[model samples]
Target: MSTYLTILGFNSAIPTVKSAPTAQFLEMEERCFLIDCGEGTQVQLRKAKAKFSKINHIFISHLHGDHVFGLPGLISSFRLLGRETPLNVYGPKGIKAMMEAIFKYTETYQGFEVIFHELSSKNSEKIFEDNRVEVYTIPLDHRIYCNGYLFKEKPKERHLNMKEISKYPEIEICDYHNLKRGKDFILKDGYVLKNEVLTTAAEPPVSYAFCSDTRYLESIVPIIKNVDLLYHEATFLHDLKEMAEYTGHTTALEAAKIARKAKAKKLILGHFSNRYADYQVFLNEACEIFPETYLPQQLEPVKI
Candidate 1:
């Protein structure tokens, strides 16, 4: 699979015995990323059997306790594990200071450098990029300066159509690489063979959007449009719309509306407030507007 997302924790505010907080482990294009290191994240990661060393990059949504309380502990664990690779942390402007102060007061020492890419721009911008994947920030409106993240895979190379290529004796094994790269092959007599004739179309790149704690903000529809999967906060029922707005959270209906407007293929609802006893209500409410909506399958790796 090119992309897999495991929900480490999805509870809001108070972490209960059954659930932790808002954190996720995303493996995209062979790159593992930790998103929003909330409390109990490390324990959840262990349960999920994730390779901690593979998580070289982390994306923090905001400074809320439920969103960032586990960051220092996770960093300490990395240090104890003797990790030498520099960790790149992408978050708001004050994240570095906050982490540094906590480490200093708590007497934590790091064996490796932690590169903090402090983000403050309200606009959506690319935060990380490599040969296989690209990540962007989705600025969110919450009580604090929060930002969601978008992970997109780079377009893959086309597959070599052996049956068609076998018809042309001039197409050698050495020409396979160029053909997959969409390059036409020129024969000795100057006759050209189109790459499309010898290669099948590549798998379409997929994208996953994480909309953390936010109000019903429709501005992000354009940014996450046509995403393969979307994980958005659905903290309250529509009956508590005023309270949801006051606390900077989204209702189940609102999250579905956002997913519908963005034309997302699937939607995962998370960050449920403890007030709700039955989680099925969330699924029922959201399914009304977006039938693809689903409650998070915690610890289960969801293919995007």
Candidate 2:
């Protein structure tokens, strides 16, 4: 099993010839999570060959059109395809009410159930928790009621060393499972076997943070520290720094600063302004401070 992240759309508010607004698809084990379904998100997913039917959970940062314009359409399509699995949506307040209005006016109905978990507070609270993962809301500064999301993998039990395990075939395989689970086993021969001697610790869990359309606020640094991967908005270049501040957005340099301060392992920058015909300037600006910075184009899949 693997945890991977894919970028479906990277533009903000507007759709350029080469880019579209904020959408990300994350694959964790057998489940998938969709973040910010902007306009044409389903189309982008089709191009990326991501299985839309596998998406049982969706997280929307805010009510902005660029962040959620495609949600209604995707839900409509799910009905057409006759999906029966229940869907869970996590978003800010008014999301549930907003979708209710749409369905009421349009007379749209789904074959499956849809559950919405509204997030209204500013504190970083646990919004979702399950056996495989946990998610929290990262309060963000934006024009509207906006926030970011953090996806953290749950700790897993250790795997036994198969070669070493084969030496004691006479031992019950059930006992070996106990040993791998950090339980000490007492062999029939009066030998005490420690769990550490037979198994190594599991690999550290990975995490991803998605900060879309937020201003340059360093307050979120502590919360996102040491994340395996971070996707922050870089909607403008240094030349338009003043405009960025006025519009509550960040430049490439500012995004890099947050990554550096947080000590993140890697930074992926996107949500570029419409003025930029080429994204090389944003790339060059961010890489100056954080060497692991990358500029992801539309439909580029970044392994987490």
Candidate 3:
């Protein structure tokens, strides 16, 4: 199975000629999730060629206009598309009311059911989980109540060694399931085969952390430590560090420092402020602290 993340939008507050606000699409285990539906998010999704029908869940980081203005438009479009699948939206308090008001004012009714999951917690907590993946909230420090999501893949089943299993003609196809579950195989001759001998260990689980629209916060380091990939907001360059903190946003240096402290495998910097015409300054500042940092472009999918 492959895990892919497409950068739909990465700019902060304002949309520029090259970027929009904060929106991303994460595809894992054949399931799709949208994070932060900023303005122009639906258009970005279309440009990225994301399967809009497959996105059952959307997670909003905060109530900022740049972060949530596109939700009503997207929901309305879904109605126009005649979608029947229920859409699950997770966000901070007041999201449901805000969305409902828009629908009511516009006299728009969705053809599909819209389920809202309101978040009120101020600590890290598991919000969603299934057999294949789990999602947790990373309490973020911002002017308003905000949260980042951490998506982690569940440990997979061991791969069956076909060559070893082929040696036993007595083994039925159904028996392969048990072998993958780490059960020893018992032959008709009463010979017991160790599970380790018949299967290879599964790949280690992968984790992705999305942190955006927040100030430099160290408290979250423990929760996201050693994450495979971290998408942290770098809203400004180091020269504007004071302005970033004043606006409850993080500078590139601060974001890189957080990644370094957490021992994250890789860092993807985003949420750029449109004021900076040169994005290379952000990359240069971050790379000085965390060499594995990356700057993603819109519509490009980064496979993990």
Q: Best candidate per lDDT, number?
A: 1
RMSD of 3: 1.3
Cα lDDT, all candidates: 0.94, 0.88, 0.93
Report the Cα lDDT for residue 20, model 2: 74
| Candidate 2 residue-wise lDDT at 34 | 97
Candidate 1 segments whose C-alpha is farther than 4 A from its true place: 166-169, 172-174
Question: Per-residue lDDT tens digits of candidate 2, residues 44-104?
Answer: 8899899899999999999999899999989989989999999999998999999989988
Compared with the true structure, the alpha-carbon lDDT of candidate 3 equals: 0.93
lDDT score for candidate 1 against the true structure: 0.94
Q: How many clashes does each candidate structure show, in the order listed? A: 0, 0, 0
Of 1 and 3, the candidate ranking higher by lDDT: 1
lDDT of 1 by residue, 112-144 (tens): 999999999999999999998999999999999
Rank by TM-score (best first): 1, 3, 2
What ranges in model 2 sit over 4 Å off?
none
